[model samples]
Target: MTGFHYKGGLRIATLLCFFFILDQPAYADGVRPGYQVVSRAEIIEAMRQCDDYDPTATTNGARFQGEMILYLAQKARARDPQGLPLFIGYENWFQAFMEVTARAEDAMPQYAQLSYQYKQNTEIDYRIDRVIREIVEAPTPELAVNVRIWWEYQPGKPDRYSYMDTLSTPNLKVTNQRVMTYRLLDFGNWVAYDEIKGLTGRPTSGILGFLFRIIGEGHILQTRMAISKDGLQFNRATAKKGFIKRIDTVTVYPDGKMEKDIPPDRPDLLEIAKRITQPLEIDYAELSGEK
Candidate 1:
C-alpha cells in the first residue's frame, strides 16, 4: 500500500527538478565589465517594466523585456554564488514576463486583465513576488527549496485543496539541491477527488468510486537533483518519516538525453529528462535588442 508511484509522478518530479536546476548558478567567474551585478533595485525596475509591457508596441517589446530579465538573472547568478537573491528575483521576473508575452501573443485582453487582477489581490507568498520582497529586505547566503502538493476526495464532503511552501537558509548542505515531494492522504486511491471531478463533474459515491481510487492515499514521492563537473543526476524516492523508503535514479546527459533505465511505455519521462539536461542556448542579437 505504501510505495513510489512512478507512472505520472515521475513527470511532475522531473519538471520541478528542472525548474530548480534552472535557478542554480553555474561555476564561473564574476560578471563581465559590460553586465552590471544584479541588485534588488534592478530586479524591481525589471518587474515594473514587465508589469507595464505593451502588446500594442511596434516592436516585440515584451519579448525584449523577458530577454533582459533573463540576462539580469544570469548575471546575478554569476555575481553572487553564495546568495540566491538574484536567482530568485530572475525567476519571478521571468514568470511575469512570460505571462505578458503569452497574453499579448494570443490577443487575449480579457484574460490578461483577469490575470493581472488576480495577481494584484493574491498574497506575495502565493506568488513569486514574495521572493523579491524577502531578497530585498533580508538576503540569505544559501537557498533551501522544498515543495509539497496533495489532494483528497471523500463523498458527501469538500473534495479538493492544495498548498505550497518555500524556505531559504544559510545552513543547508545542498545549496543547489531541489526536492519535490507529493503525499496522497487517502488510502488506495489513485485518482484524487479533483481528477474525478474534472472528468465526471461530480464526486461519485459507493464501491465503484472506491475502486477507481487505486492510487492510494498517503503515498509520498520525493525527487532530488545533484550537479557535478560531469553532468546532472536526479534521484527519485518514496519517503516515510525522514528516511527514503524506496529509490530510483535517472542520469541526464549534456545533450539533454537520458542515460538511465526508463520504461518504454513512459516516453514522456524520457522527453522531460532530455529537455532538462540540455544546455541553454540564447541568441545574443535577440537579447541585445538588435533588429
Candidate 2:
C-alpha cells in the first residue's frame, strides 16, 4: 500500500484553524476551572523545572502532584474547535491499535508472533518514534518528515506494512490491506486509516471484473483519529473528523440507548482539575540551595 506524506504548510494551516476556533464562546467554556492557556515558554519552563523539582522534599509529594495536575490541565485544555486535546493523542492511537491487534490475535494466535517483526521491518520513515521525534526536533516552516503507515495482512503470512509512501499500491491477490496517513499539526496529529474492503478484491476477468474495471475499486472505510504529539494522552477517535466535534459527558448502552450530557464515569480528571485550581501543597519560598 502507499504511504502518505504531508508538507510543513499543513501544520501552519492546522494551527491557524485550531486557534481561530478558540475565539468561539463554546471553546471558551470548554476550559474548566484551573486550566489556563499555556504558552510554549511556560511549557518549556515547566518541563525543565519539573524534571528536577523534587516532590519528595514536600509533604507526601503533594506539591509535585499538584504541579503535574496543573500541567496536565493546561495541556488538556489545548484543544481545537473539534475538542481534540494536545497531550493525549498518542495514548488514543495506541489504544485503538491495541484493540484491533488484540482481536486479530485472539482470533489467530499466529498474529502475535509477527507483532514485533512488523514494527521492526516497517519502513524507517513512518516509524512511530521517528515521526514524532522528527517533528519535535525540527518544527518549523519546512518540515522533513513524511508520516504514514501501510500494512497488509494475509491469513497465515507475516503482516506486510509500510514499505512505501504513495497514493496507492498494487493490490495483492489475497491480502487484506490498510493504509494510514498522519497530518502532523502544531496542535496535534490527525491520523486517518483506510481499510481496503468491498468488491475491489474480486477478480478482474469476469462480469464482476468488467464492472470493477468501470467503477475502479471498492469503497474504503476511513477512520479518523486525532491525538497529542507523544501519542500518550488525549484523543478523538473512531469516526470521521466532523462526527464527534465536541466532547460531552454521555453514556451509550449496548442496546443503542443514549444519554446526553451526563456525568462522566471517572472522577480522576475532576479531582485533578480541582487540585490544579488550588495552591501547591508545598511552600517553594522556603526551599534553599536548589535551583
Candidate 3:
C-alpha cells in the first residue's frame, strides 16, 4: 500500500507499459488549440467579465473553481511541451464541469444506468481561473491535469458492482484501468507490487523498503545523469567550466527508514502515474455569465 499520495483526489503518478494504441487523431491545425489555451492571456479579463460559479460540483469540492482556474491553467502549461493546447474545447471548462456535475446529480435521482459512467467525475474541469492560481503558487513544475477511473460490473448482472475506484494507468485519458495498467506492465523495467512480492520470498516491507535497503545495507551504486550548467545557457556557451549538480532531500519510508535516489530509467513512474489519471472533458463556454 506504499504508493502515490492522493492529493485530495486520485491521480495516477505512475504508468504501465502494456500495449494498446489510440485511434483518434490530433486536430487539423497540426496542434488544435482549445479555449483553455487561449484563455491563458484572457484569464484575468474573463474573470472581470465573470460572475459566480456554483461550487458544489468542482473537484476538491470546488477548491479549484471560480477565480482559481487562472493559476490551474499555468500549472497545466508549465509542464507542457511549449506549444501544446488544452485538450478539451469550449470556454470555462470548470463551469462546464459544474453544470455536468449538477446534471449528473440531478439525473441521478431519475436516470438509471447513467450512474455507471460519466466523463466529468474522472477528470476535474480545467477551469481558467483556477489554472492561473496553481501556476503562480506551486514550487514544482506546473502540469496539465488528467484522470482515470475504474468500474466494476458483474458479468450477467452488470449493474452489481462490488467496488469502484479510479485505477492508476499511464496515459492522459479518462479510460478504464485495463488500458492504463497494460501500458506500464509493458515497460521492461517496471515491476508490479503484487508480482514482486510474490517472487521475492523474503519479508520485504515494500518498494520504499527495497529502495532504502539498497541505499543503506546494500552496496552497489553509480551516477545517473549529468547536466552541466555554468553560465546559464549550456547550449549557447560551448566553452565554460560547468559543475555537477547534486540533488537534495532524502526519501523517508513509513518505517522511518531513509534512502537516496530512486532507480534510474525505471520507466518514469511519475509519468506513468500521470498517464493513468486521465482528465474528464468539460466545456467552459457553457458557464459564461452564470446563465
Q: Pick the candidate with the highest TM-score.
A: 1
lDDT for each residue of candidate 2 in 189-247, tens digit (9 for 90 to 100): 22222221210122245464465556543432222222112211111112112232222
- TM agreement with the true structure for every prediction: 0.25, 0.21, 0.19
> Candidate 1, TM-score vs. the true structure?
0.25
Candidate 2 local lDDT, residue 263: 31
Query: Stretches of candidate 3 above 4 Å error?
Result: 1-136, 139-143, 152-259, 262-291
lDDT of 1: 0.26
lDDT string, candidate 3, 60-160, tens digits = 11112212332333445455534332332222333343344455534421111222232111122233333223323212212222211122223453321
lDDT score for candidate 2 against the true structure: 0.25
lDDT for position 281 in model 3? 25
Q: Order the candidates by lDDT, highest first — what do you get?
A: 1, 2, 3
